[model samples]
Target: MRGSNSSLSSLSRRQPWKLINIADLPDAVLIEVVCRLSCSKLIFRCKCVCKRWLTLISDPYFVDHYLRHQSDKKRHIIRTLIYAREYVVRLRFHPWTNPTVVATYNDLMLCYGNLNRYCICNPCTMQWVALPRIPTYTVHRRSEVRVGFICDTPCYNYKEDEHEDQKGDVMQHNAAYRCKVVRIRPPEKGYYHFSFEWKVDIFSSETGEWRKAVVLSPRAITLNGLGFPHQGILYWLGREENGCSIIFGLDPFSDKPKCFFIALDEPLNDLRHFGVCGGCIRMCGLDMATRSLIVFYLKTEEDGKLCLSKRMVYSLDQNMYLDNESNVSLRPFDPNDEDVCYIYVYGECVRYKYNFRTRKWSTIVEEIPHQISYSFVHVQPWWPTPVPRLPQRACPAESN
Candidate 1:
């Protein structure tokens, strides 16, 4: 019996019990398991588990595959985190500090501090990269300089056979969308003084450099606040010199900037806003006579021209809280679910939420405007699209 017991003890010592031998698992299965993790930081740490795991995690092919899968499954969720509030569950431990918004694309957010500092962060992982100084333009008053963050539009996720170029295309293509910061400045003397010309600057992670260009726009358009990007084009709410509110579409990949009529009737009012939904640009307007808010979906054909169609109309229940000039926008919950969106009604000292799914209306918190400088965290799964790196720096205010 002593001999038998000794043999058993030796066997147990030689191979202790493990929950499961991850190393023994098939490489494909192990990768799938790692891809299911909720937090990338955790996955990153898991890479140190073993050499095989490390090789799989570090491979560009695996990274691109994972990103494409996550993006395709639409497994992530986007929840706006108001930075001002304390005691957020789980995230309370991270140091959000005084986060000022600069730009947003997918789950990535670029922000700057009150000083001329900058950072690119993913709230989901609380992982951030501090970036070096932008090559062109310095922080200035809101009237002079404006900054926006955008990435190349994501491609449709589809399964393809493994090949060198296949991996390269997916990895290189996805890495391109890592994040690009755009800084626009009006020439101090002329453009800032209604010269209508603005300087465009871009910082690309691929090249890790900033390039500057000038848009010698003769037409006037609203150049205030953040701009929107879609299908490789960036959009902003602006008005023509004739006082007609128009939507200006800027192709970041090109120098051509054009303006399109936002409303059927000329809307010179400043209470208008726009958002991207269902791959279309939605614009807000007011029917001056009826005082009802009108929303239109502007669709662009392959030829690059835009056509507008009235999508929905919302009538105010209580005019006291709602005004003819209320800022209205529709934020789609997910690209996969196009039928649903959240209507954000701002201005008039009142804030409310309108649900398009059930056509229900309710007043949400009023401090949302203050919470504007926040980030969206969607824990849902997304298809793999490899991303790049950036860091935070001390700079002026950033946009989202």
Candidate 2:
């Protein structure tokens, strides 16, 4: 028996550790595995695991990764509901039929609807909630609207001596996040009277109240399209006095709305859609003739100045914009996709995928349903609510 036991011990010592199957791994290991996958796949498979896994995958970092991956794939679609006349109009990817009207928000369809009401729907969960009634005071005269999240500022200091004690722990946590609503009210009375006064109001979900931010100056009156919020910043396309269009970025945490001028190679007349692409800002505009589409990259110069660099211009069919008198809506289908962007014409939507190497714009989707509006919503990653990291402790003065 001793001889046999000795032999078995020796065999065990010589054998390598058995490879761990994904099914047999611990929760942490499994989570790491899921994190490495693409966002869509991660979201699809995350629920298969237990509730704990669901919670972990919702982390903001995971959300960031998922959004980034989706953008990279050029698969992100903007949902808009248009409410006009008496019928509700919904626009999506399908070209044969009208896009489905899902929900509404801030007197606008969350998907695609008319002017009086809008819907707010969660696409992934296939759920939606109706927004409050559109205030009659400003519903008719307003030109543009937007929604965003707002959170209370986190305390920057908590401890002095424990700075290095929980560095890893702090890095893993997510800071507090909240949602806020923004509305851009313009002064344009049907007539040629151009009242440049514009006001921005913010609705905080946590406070359940609406507070007015600083009113934009008349000289800052070149805002064309709706505002888009990403990475805690709200962005909009604005035209300068010289008729050149640029993008303006506003930090919700700050008091004044600062301008981040996007430098384009050529001058554009009307700017429409602005979105997040590969962690950078992207702006789309219509050419002077309205038959072509122009894209600008929101980049920073060597001096760290933010500017818009002209990326490319895509021309559609000759008569595409011949009779269309309204402005064009150009948005990025996938926030992660840097090569392709989607444009909304009068009755149809087209996708413009750019190949930087070839310097060409390939039309992907020729005909899509014409919806009134579209907005990009984000799905946060599974993780615990993040606590703000305490500021680094000031080091004691070094002795001379």
Candidate 3:
């Protein structure tokens, strides 16, 4: 024992090699390692370590590569929604690099930090491109306004697995074309709070001018500022003052808009939401009485343009709901989240998830409810890559 201890002391005193730092790694090697990371929350926090690491992370090529992986992975960490209070916040952090997302279509978002300004950006890649302010306004009860933007992708087949016996089939949405932005404005003097008279102006990249719709739609109020693209067409579900539900559809090829209001088969009582899931229109109804969500897929037929077929009825877990005092509509939104979907952030934050294969439901994220459209900190939507394009950002943000 004495001899072994003496030998160990002599060897310890002999020598020790210098420690290696993560910063010493090559750019390619570091990038490969960092791209696998789930979200930028950690990256932004750790970027303060060294200038070389910062510079490498800022490279557009590396950023693009990472975002490509992010889109494929479908792991969204930042939950970007809207603020009901509409508080105008200043640049608290790096607004350009870590921008605030206002509205989202697919993975692309209408982002702006300060009010009255807007831009389109992919948060996953940290690639931001500025968009011109849409010069239009609508006068609703509070002069409320809504904006519309659409992203085009090449030949995205949304209904790849439709039943074979279906009589009619919706054509594949040709997304390869350039995207267009639309601004809708209701006349200030003539329109009532429930007026259907509205005008739409579209901005296309091919033609740099804003073009007006061929026909003004009576159901334009259904647009509601945001448009959902399904099978290459944009749709907005609306309900008028008299309580009649309407559907507004815009065909990209013809630039023609149409409105239809056929009676719904079922008498809907609770608040409902419409969204595009798997390239088809899906409606989710929040039933506060039983604390259950009724989901239906909208099908088109020769007789009736809008048809609702029951998809699934998901019950909100008592543990997730936690509050029995209020039967107020939770307003379930953003069905894109896979493990769970975000319901309204009212007095309490409520969220749930459904499995398509198993048709199972689970409570994933729940927190104290905040303002409207505001996403929580850890549970954020992974912004997807709309298409493959190099971003031209307003602030050549430090990804030098």
Best lDDT among the predictions, by candidate number: 1
Pick by TM-score: 1 or 2, better one: 1
CA RMSD of each candidate after superposition: 7.0, 11.8, 9.5
lDDT scores of the candidates, listed in order: 0.56, 0.47, 0.52
Estimate, for each residue in 1-400, the C-alpha lDDT of model 2 and write its tens digit: 9999998899989995698766677755765567556444446566667766677666545554444444445653433322332232223322213333332222222332345443344333433333333456656533344333333432121222345663322222224434445665554542122334555665443443455665544353356555665445566666656665555555555456443444343556456554455555666667756466666666555554465554766666553433664645554454444565555554444444554335565666644445544443333332222311221221112100
Candidate achieving the largest TM-score = 1
Estimate, for each residue in 1-400, the C-alpha lDDT of model 3 and write its tens digit: 9999998888878965578887778888889888887776576555677888788766655655565566567754554444434322422233554345444565555554343445655544455555544444422332244455665663233333366874333333332456666555555543335554666666564553456664455443433434555554566545555554445666544456554443333323443445555544676555566667666677766643566654677766566555653533444454346334445424455455555446565655554244343331212433234332323432233222
CA RMSD (A), model 1:
7.0
The candidate with the higher lDDT, 1 or 2, is 1
Assess candidate 1 and give its lDDT.
Answer: 0.56
Clashes of each: 46, 53, 16
Worst 10 residues of 1 by lDDT: 391-400
